[model samples]
Target: MSRDGTSASRNAPLVGTLLVLGYCVINSTKSVFEGSLVQHLSPEFIAFNSFVLAQGFYFMICRDKAALLATVRRCLPDVIALNVATMVSWVAVLYAFTVFEPAMANSVILGLVPSITIALGFKLRPGVRALRLEVVAALGMLAAMSFLVAAAWNGSSAIGDLPKDDLAAGLIYCVLTSFALSAITYFTRRLGDQGMSVQQMMASRFGVLILVTLGLLIGRDSFDAYTPRNIGAILLISIVGVIVSLYLLQAGMVRTEPITVSMLFGTNLIITYVVQFLDPRLHQSTTTFVGVLVLSAAMCLGAWARWRDGRDNPPAGVPDKVPAEVPAEAEGTTQNVGNRT
Candidate 1:
């Protein structure tokens, strides 16, 4: 290779790391913004606008129309399944944000995603072996989530004066988000195995939600909600959170190791908590502090376990082993765990 080529190759990982970190920070901040927007705009309206804008952006930038169309036609069922999963996840997480603090909602959804994905992976693919460390890490995350739920139930959460009923509903929505995301990850992987690129998958994944959300908007005549301010907010989030964030993630995944990507993405929790703390509108309690700490630890442990597994069982002909639980791209929302919305 030329000297310049060698230099560029050497710096690729660093560049990729920076891009992924940028994605983490941007998505985390967008989650807080979504929470605030939900106070004025219904989750369905926000979701509808986000999907429509993202679809437009993806369609315009997509370079391989022939390849994308071939893949969609060949794997039509899987494509539909992935779109359905994305729709459910986007709606659930957005609704969850309406009731829960953005930080708390992000923490629960991102923190529990790996565990949920792992469990579902095992159930769907019985022959795959589960790592002992990964199992322990999953249990730790569950326990931490349980503690956070208990805190919310007793009204001792960092978000002050949350009604128990609303909090409970929010938590349920978070769980639903996790499940939908797991399904999204699964279907994304399946389509990948069938030769679909991340860009193609993204281009195809929003169609179902676009139709569903558009129908709801038309039925309710929610176009009145599209004031200048709301349009600006939705466009900002769709551009930064959905389009640019997922682009960064896809680019980073190509150059960086999966373990690095997992760890960097895990930092979203801290970034989110700090942003929430700075926002005067949000509240933080002692339990919230402890919960963040616990969730962070759980995330690190899970990342480490995945790293160790890759080390012990390196895939043949592959230089970097992809983390099994981290999805390569996020759709719709700004916070989709590994992909982050």
Candidate 2:
């Protein structure tokens, strides 16, 4: 009994680490393309592309359309909240880049997300406990993040480094962006709260994001900006940056500790950290290591918590132990869909 418990406990952090590392590689794979696309592509296009791809994947992978449609319909209201939040995060991040250095802006804005996720995770699961082992792991990763930050300082040249004013601006942007993401995570968790499956939640997030961003694009007069270069960027953004990135992320969310991986996701900041060495013209900072360390520690802690909490996660197709008040229609639809699948 003791050995089994020890093994499971050990597996918890391993799962969490792998989850973050996987996403790091996924997001990093296209980081080069991502920065340029963000500059050139319309927000609406990016949002639309990602959401469509996400939904396409969801619909294809879902075993049952009945349940999918039912959950989507039932969960639509909550998804709007998520879409708005994410839309804001996207816009702010782009704008932040204008005023702050990308690395600095990413460090603060992206770093805040993990902390927000951890906070929201607990808000969603009030009964979840904090574990000591996870805390140690968080510390270790934080030390690593510090190394990365230092590595960044020691590392890049092409990226922006936030000056005092830029740092201030970055913080302001990061805080708001963090708030927006809190909503994204919170509402998605609420979708889960409403008895929607992962498929339903991912589908709704994509569908709503696409619709909303498309509407915004039309209104913002961003249509005339399209050139062949922009068109290809949007397509690439959709296929690699948006769809593939989101698919990997959502899958990670489903399979592992979301808050933990979310925290570890702070590594996304200096997307060019390691590669910038080839150029040697990129800006590097020594403090980046310390910042990375702090961020990593927080994420590892969050992952540990998520792993510990996952044990209590309701099995597939079951309500949480507390019993969410799902609508009768929702229950029927889920059952119908499950049966069909």
**Please, what is the whole-model Cα lDDT of each candidate in the order they appear?**
0.75, 0.52
RMSD, one per candidate, in order: 3.5, 9.1
Error of 1 at 285 (Å): 2.3
Q: For residues 1-341, could you state the per-residue lDDT of candidate 2 as single tens digits?
A: 69998897668557646654665655554444444455556546655665565568666777877887777677777767776776677656655644434454555554544444445556655564435554444445435534544443433424544355654564566577766765665565567667776555545555555666778778886753557776666666566665565555544443444444545554554443453344333455545545644654555455545545556764587543222222111110001100000
Error of 2 at 103 (Å): 3.4
Number of the top-ranking candidate, with lDDT as the measure: 1
**Candidate 2, which segments miss by more than 4 Å at Cα?**
1-20, 29-32, 40-45, 49-66, 114-170, 224-226, 249-272, 275-281, 305-341
Return the TM-score for candidate 1, rounded to 2 decimals: 0.91
lDDT of 1 at 194: 74
Lowest-lDDT window of 10 residues in candidate 2? Answer: 332-341
TM-score, candidate number 2 = 0.63
